[model samples]
Target: MTDIVMEAKNVYKTYGGSSKKADLKLVEAVKDVSLQIRKGDIKLIFGPSGSGKSTFLRCLAMLDIPDKGEIYLGDECLTKPGVDLNKARARIGFVFQNIYLFRHLTALGNVELALRRVLKLPKEEARERALAALTEVRVTDCANKYPAQMSGGQAQRVGIARAIVRNPDIILLDEPTSALDPELTGEVIDTLRDLAKEGTTMLIVSHEMPFARDVAEEMIFYDEGKIVETGPPSVFFNAPSTDRAKKFMDRIIKRTTRE
Candidate 1:
């Protein structure tokens, strides 16, 4: 059997609840969601804006705690409130849409800092791992450059290198290419494809349809905080089981052809 790296069971998460009548209403971001990510699986999630895909990814990464249900990393419980999470969290990596590199730090320094501080690797070892990671993303040439000095793509590559320096069991990305121009976006997509080929398990929430269809082992269509359909790209892209999925594909195709 393929090993599962992360699993969610009936997970639920909400935001912005208040007793006051004038206050914003509660938003159910994830509702009764359950899924498993197998080792080395490139799982792609697609949905419209505010469809809860990003929220679910954050819950998996534990950046946003779920209001109900359970999450597991391997055999250990990961979502129990107040549980010791350092070890569980250490095994996961996350890259966000907004590349959050410290402007003062060089690309190499940014990656090395995560290795030394979070993983507590020795200085020399961290340097070696950081450089390897930079090379993996083809950002080695930008290692000594600061974030302000690099293009959007280069900065994001550094962000990815920092995320993978420790070799986490699974990497989570939220709209990694949504902000880049076509040329830069292609580079990021190429880097991600290389990682997938190298057996890095990933859960990606993206609108890059072509890349998702090509790289994903499984694709999920989420709507209103629920997974409407899940299948391989061959089925999801060509023959979606749900009307919502079909409509989504139609809209996307129309938009692409128009552009």
Candidate 2:
């Protein structure tokens, strides 16, 4: 049997609230979404703006809690509201689109901080792991450089290194290349592809179709808080069965051609 690394069941999340007189609109960002990710599987989630892909990713990462549903990392329950979130978070790495390294910290410092603070490793051991993680992302040369001294791509590599240094079972990426220049995105994508080859299970929120097609085991088409389609790239890209999916693909094509 395939080992299920993580699973989300009937998850629902909403935002916005109301006072006594004011009617606050509730936005259902994630709607009864169920998903399963097997060990070493790379799943890509794609959608346009306001499609709730990022919110869904945050829910998976436990950066945000769902209003209702259960999230499981193997046999451990992650969405029980009062559950030990720190323990759950330790098992999942997260790379955000915006690189938020400490301004004063060098690349090695940024990565080692996570190991020391979250994993509680000794300074010497954390330093060793940090270097290994930086080398894995091919950013060892930038180890001594602060975020301000590095390029966008190089900084992102350090962010990735921070995530992987924890040795989590899954790594969640939120539009990891969206903030990067078209040219600068290649290095980060290369690192991600290498991670895939090394059997790092990942769930990525992205619109970078070419990278997803090449590395993703499956693609999920999420729009308006729901999954419109889910399948291998061959099926989702070449033979989308839903009208919503077809229109979304058309939009992607138009945007790509214009660029």
Query: Highest lDDT, which number?
Result: 2
lDDT of 2 by residue, 106-209 (tens): 99999999788888899999999999999999999999999999999999999999999988999999999999998889999999999999999999999888
CA displacement after TM-score superposition, residue 105 of candidate 1 (Å): 0.6
Candidate 1, 1-259: lDDT as tens digits: 4499899999999988886667778899899999999899999998889989999999998888899988988887788767778777778888999999999999999999977887789999999999999999999999999998999999999989988888898999999988899899999999999999999999999878888778998888998999989999889768888888999988987886685
The window of 10 residues in a row where model 2 has the poorest summed lDDT is 250-259
Give model 1's TM-score versus the native structure. 0.96
Evaluated at residue 6, the lDDT of candidate 1 is 95
